[model samples]
Target chain A: MNTNSDYPKRICSTTGFPICRSAEFFVKANAVLGVVFLLIGGIAAILIALTRWQAVHLLPVDWFYRILTLHGINMLIFWILFFEVAILYFVSTTLLKVRLASRLTAWISLVMMFVGAVMVDVTILLGKADVMLSSYLPLLAHPAFYLGIILVAVGTLIAVGNYFATLYIAKKEKTYEGSVPLVVFGATAAAIIAVVTLLHGAVVMVPTFLYSLHLCPQPDPQWYRLLWWGLGHMSQQVNVCAMVAVWYLLAAITTGAKPLNEAVCRSAFVLYILFINLASAHHLLVDPGVSAGWKIWNTSYAMYLAVLASMMHGFTVPASVEVAMRGKGYVRGLFGWLTNAPWRNPGFSAFFLSLLIFGFIGGITGVTLGTQQINIIAHNTLRIPGHFHATVVGGTTLAFMGLTYYVVPLLWRREYILKPLCRLQPYLFGIGILIMSFGMSFAGSMGVSRRSWDIDAGGSIYGPTAHLFLALVGIGGTVAFIALFLYVGLTVGTLLFGRRIAAGKSMEDWGTPKVLSTSPGHDHVAPAPGFAGGATVAEAHPTQGTMVLAVIFLLSFAVYYFANWKALADVWPVR
Target chain B: MNQESSSGLECPKPGWFQAPSGNERTWIGMAVIWCLILSVMMPYWHFRGKQNSTGEAYRVKPADFVKRVEAFVKVNTGEESLVEDGIAPVVPAPPGEVYLLAKQFFWFPVLKLRSGETYRLHISSADVQHGFSLLPMNMNFQIVPGYDHVLTIKPQAPGTYHIVCNEFCGIGHQQMVGKIIVE
Candidate 1:
């Protein structure tokens, strides 16, 4: 039952609460890195948005394309990856009430990832590659770009290994009892996907890298396309899982409420695990080479189940929110509780707005565009980015920001800096994102293509309508940039300079209580009296090595599938 | 006068003079408003009309056009001096099927009709990459560019439907418009 011993020794000195040095260090390190990534990505998003504005036509064609490519990748890929890594760290340690299994491995992973990210940006800046982020095959990039990506994938693999090791150690030491907590389970699933996805990245990129250096002939486009999807689709699923996990985490932190029905939450995660992979074919719906029947089966029919799962969660989470608010005695219409809810609370506000924005734009467009009839019109257009921003920025990024407000302070044992600003940041960013998404959708409807260098060339296909929409998009980008800057400033300041708060006082004492402790042996663990849930601590925690190994095996399968299929055409014949 | 007096004598029964309850009146008002709105929007449903084409509908077929193109190509190629004339030389459509070329921004079609009609026209790109939109008037279909999208326009109207690429090719994308005149 002495979970405290597993955590670093916390001396209750002048601080009036136990402060674990290791927890504090990890929390602070994550905050700093989170801020840096947010700043870079936010600036890039703003620049891209502003270019759409009327005032800035100054950049030349090639320069503009390069900048836009960097901006898109940075905001979409880099920002999300940075936040997910930090979340992985937090979920493994804080949620499970255990320290990281290996600090050295974690640090090494961070350094390697940082190096890889920098190399990519530098290569992009040097104009060595402008594959426009998607980098579809036949279009090649500089060797540095591929190498950078490989390093990043390897770094993530290492981090996943460390997380699994920590979980194994926790089970060995017997931290808790019975079924893994929902949030941890979801994170573990995401990490499993991440490993599989990254391994695919290695498989695809290693050959591509060699080919670029003339050590091998170019890989066939069809082969590259299929292999890339393994990475692309699976990484997206990781985001999906992580986003959902944050939703549950936020609910616990904000209202001191767990999912009203645990089965629903678990079922949603299960649905994602089973159905998300097949849904990746939606991206290939308009592609010429794929068969009509295969597209229908993989993209359309397969996606419907995942869509249903999302809708289920969409309804369930809000219903839980409503119930929690209703319990607080806001007796009004179904929507009245929303109006009466505390807007000042950053966690509540961000979670609420992010959920709304993502579901309406991201979720709707995703479903519509995934359909065969619609994908023909929407693919490779501005619509693609519009759909993703709705999901990634509005969904995952917002959730990460909201979570940081709690986790940073909780881990660091410091009060949030600029409390008012923290509350304002989410709304500003959320509104800005909504505006940007709307503009992009309008442009797409007008048939504005994505990844274009010059939309207004002499013989260009786009007309005045495209120009107008791009301008509006620029305005939205500017607003988002400012909001993100504010967020980074607030988050970083809170971690380092915010007024310190007492530690023993749970997150609720600061404002609202969002976390739940179901793990036994911890003092704050949820109690189930009279032996119904009681068990020996050792029996409570099961070794997680099997789960970890299972994930690694899945990754290996994906890698082998890609490599073998590319090398030998007949190895995995199409039916 | 008697009728008026009889009607009025029922004491103009001040029908529940109290103002209607807010909730009840609101519900009634909402219902009326919804009904009115639905009625106005209903007419749009039939705007496309009922002139539906069934799968069994008779229309022009591709085989007839192929024969016409082959005859033209054979006759034109036989006379070597025909190519030297100032008149535009006629080229045959490929042996088996229709061949349309879609380039950086243009759709070019070579058409030969069953009635010994030969028409060759140039489709140029206006803005970005656009598909040559070929739709049979009164038929339920469209053909996009970049793929081998061929159609036997019967020259029914002997006019153009204006081929525009649905894909957003670039800035002039909207302006990249082409016309198909079948004669």
Candidate 2:
């Protein structure tokens, strides 16, 4: 161990990963702030949900728009990005066993992020910015709103720079041997995407900020939408990359799973780095100032190479888990490994559940809705939110929560306060988000608009189907809100009051994680002898069940994709 | 203390960079094919299918677009009975070009159209960016302040379709609804 006591680095007693003390402090700070913003966003979510429900229409018109804008920023930008910064720090310094590149830059980034987040919240509450998250041109918000977002973006860019710098130092000092671990590589991919996303934010937001101050002429509306989604949707692509990284990390820590093929996994991440940003075009598919050819080519990501990346991860992640589970002697049927695997461990359950939600619901709907022609049926509707809620909330956020379960125990050296609630939390949250996403998609299919304070404002009744789905949105939102509250309450309570893990001891409530290369007991989980990479390994450990699941996912994608086209055909002829 | 070998926490033991075989390879190939299919479907629809966003747009000032809509409304407004409160004129659009303008809280000049005839429907926002979302049928497009987004369309059924501004403009976004009467 590189026992650099002067720089405050120590090895974790539990997971045996090196813990850079300064990095750990920033991780805790950013995560705590992330949770705080989640609470704020969650409150906004419930209010917006109730108001959209129509029967229980909660907030007044102005408050609805204000809180809607608040919800968009707090949840989408603040909560997710803050947590991502924490992940970047953790993955880089800890995974590579090095000190944080610079504690000063980390602190500067954190303070700027926090201050900017506050400025944004205050400005929105003061009724200065009513433009929605997109904040398309000519619907100007206060200059402070744009400045606040720019600050947050610049801060995130600094953190990403710190991450890269840490990687540089790790390589120079020879912290670890050979290629970086898969998780570190994945984080590198996310950081790369973040750089691109933040640059787009600077390009669009700086001018918009000036325009809000009446200092520059308005950026063209179409031009603004084009550049803004480069920041907006591409940021979600960053989340996808980071979430997949966590999936791999949690899989290894919880189940001793290793990548079946490192080359495949790394190349998939490369696909994301290369082709994912092109997907920003999907947002403008139905809008003007872009041609059909441009929309199709760009929305497809030059033939969906990035989606192929997601599909690759979707299979490899679970197949590795299956191999690990089957090696534990659960090899009965196609799914016996899945059935007998760790369902109780919060980390294991959250990771697996996030995989299912992200792959089955989120990934399927996203590709279908992002189709250039299909977007005509779904653009700016509740379906758009429906698709992303699956990816962002159900997939990314749930995966983060799962990782947090282990992070708290492993990093903070603390046991959970309520063990039972921790186990129940993932299912509750996953199911709630699933229900909510369905409601949004179905209601949207019935011509219900998103971002509206009231759907029935014009006395145009949308019959019973739309009403029923909106009710589902309300019910699902309520369930998710409750689950979110429980998660926050449990997390905070555990941090404050949970028992400390004494040194040289494993987590008692959650079993000691089975480390893959260390334990003689898990020797069976290792790849076949000599790493010969073929039919021998495939025969020894079967992923027939994952193959089955993948088939089901593909089928679902086909049905949903063609169904949207069918629906588009039923509408009036337009070109 | 447990002396742990850095398995996951470190780089994989050397020679871990192996190609995916069997089920994993098959899935990758299938995914690539599905992606190709997804890519092909869009351009196929653009050429062969009726429902496509041609995205035919022209840059016009907000005031210019509003004036064009007013002129179009003035030319078309004749003998059409009031739909409801008559806050907006119920203009009968001929079988050529129709202009619809979206502003803060309302869409101007409720349009009356005939079924089974193509109209080059030009939509633009008078001020901020808004959405030209025709409900029930649920065909939607963007209404930008300076860009006239034209959708060439023919309504198939005779009914009153509500046009709502799905894009967030301001506090009164929910009340921004107009009607398109198809006869």
Candidate 3:
């Protein structure tokens, strides 16, 4: 393939990562949009949290709902998708060592997505679209609201097409030999799920868009919910896939950790593509007109396959890190690898934090809550948000944030502006999210309603503990908000005015290592500067610490799972 | 860990479909067992577990269901609630199935039931989708229009449990609250 001669290309001296002008444009464009949405959402989060806080009760009812709508749409939908779109461009171009395919199409999609996101935000801010993120039908919003979502989804679909085309181009041009990199494979899964999810968006939103115009009859609420979750819940699965992909990418990039087994990891990604979206049916388990067999089938056995995929990831990621650590001969005890793991590196720390919270909080809670009978107590409570916030905000968002640390210095050619603050950011954010999610989950278990602007409703009862937990949510949310502001401020400051790198290439010190081509030898540390971060022990074994962590995770899962059942049994004692 | 760092990258390819290592197989086996156990729990609970959410279903028009609930409430408007305002008085309904109409902002009437009586409670939404969440007890189900969900439940303890609409219906959705008083 001939270079267009118009597009600039360069390889980074520090990381050896390729930078294509066209791909960089897409990355910067989408990433900036993601940040913009984050800012809007973060502000809205504070207001909503304050309102939900019983003592303060900041925003009025309508404003509370309106702000909550903006918060959900901006953070969950717009911000994450925009960032993932950016990731797709990066994967197809820089990772594959190929120029981005179809620059014009990418630009068009970017513009359309931006316009749609703006349109949705404007509709919500104007107080005409407070139907919450679901915007359940018969509760009409402005026609523009539906149109905005449709445009965003359609735009994302187009971008996904461009991603596939780029992959095809990579293959045709013989960018690399045999299978693509693990990062690329995982990204491929995410893109595949994204296309399917966007289609579901079209399936529901098109009719609702038309209904808003009085051009079509309203679909049955049950039917709408069935289809709509294919969009709503499945879209988050895209994030899950992306987050996992990024996890692998970060592990390799930061720690030089080889995936413990490429085949198993790839199989896990394949499983996500095949069965993850079906987990959406768990949302409808309590719904009437849906059969028991359907609910049980979807939630119980089939969805477990997806859960298996998540479990595989939960194992392989940390195990891979352990392999890397043990390769450097850190095997002193069961936790030697963990002890030697990079704590100061924000890139590593954030990813590690994400993995922990996502599994313990999100994964265990998700499986427990998704259970057919167990959903009766958990569904439509704050636990729903609690579960997803762990997955999305704590897991995926943290990963993305971590990835950005490398992107700024390596891709943007600017050193991170506030390194000390950057190191502390993830811990602060992770702690805040921890408190918020647990507080919400415990409160929800106490029967606090979700999506209700007020918990202290007329005729509905709540215990004293519920108010305390709500207060915790408010405080945690405030802390998270401040952390988010710091992140955005630092990120923006870095891009604009951070020190420009002057070819400060090192003596094979800390930079991008070569992509591993063989199964790792646990005893031999690679002769790389960052690879041997003070190897402390003699006898080398991989993932000993990880195995212990896995055991702990399993025990926690068992305790939480049976505890829910115990709670259920307490309601109706079986003799 | 790969050797080349800081410059000139080599796009290396490893054994793509390598067999699972020892730890990998062990974890996979554990996962399989855990998954099967969870699945078994579902069937076991559905068969013998008393907290099974799956129950009877019936179809009813919103017009008729609302009328039945209104009549039931009219007859049983004897014991006023001390805890909350605007609540219609509660009294025990006779055996068999009873009606609960879910509309814009409330359930039609407070259901008063005996603690051990297994009454088939028929619930339906009058307008859109609502949720009948029995709080404190932590029992919930979707109330959909045109589909009456008949739940055969025996309230375990004699107490007042709030029935709140957990699903988002509309602007006044936050206010939709009812009560289930078990005597």
Best by TM-score: 2
Each model's lDDT comes to 0.57, 0.86, 0.80
Give the number of the best model, judged by DockQ.
2
Docking quality (DockQ) for each candidate: 0.02, 0.60, 0.42
lDDT of 3 by residue, A140-259 (tens): 789999999988999999999999998887788777666777788888899999999999899899999888898999877777888889998889999999999889888877776766
Looking at candidate 3 chain A, the ten consecutive residues that score lowest on lDDT are A531-540
TM-score of chain A, every prediction, order shown: 0.84, 0.96, 0.93
Cα error of candidate 3 at position A62, Å: 0.6
Order of candidate numbers by DockQ, starting with the best: 2, 3, 1
In model 3, residue pairs whose N, Cα or C atoms come closer than 3 Å (at least 3 residues apart or on different chains), thus clashing, are: B105-B176
For candidate 2, the lDDT comes to 0.86
Candidate 2, residue A105: CA error in Å? 0.8
RMSD of each: 16.9, 2.9, 4.4
The stretch of ten residues in a row with the least summed lDDT in candidate 2 chain B is B1-10
Off by over 4 Å in 1: A1-24, A301-303, A458-465, A502-575, B1-183
Instruction: Estimate the TM-score of every prediction.
Output: 0.71, 0.96, 0.93
lDDT of 2 at A382: 93
Instruction: Give the per-residue lDDT of model 1 (tens digit) for A1-575.
Output: 64546467454332233443664465456546656766776766665666555447645556666776677666655666666777777666655556678778878887887788789889988998766665654557899988887887788788789889878866776654444566887788788878878877888889999988989997755457667777876787788788888887776557643343444455667777776777657666544345545655566435356655565556546655554454454435435446666677888888877787777778767765664434544556677788888898888888888887877666666778767778888999888888888878778666565555444442444557767778777777677778888888776787679887675554433355333333443323222232221011112222122123223433443353233223222111111
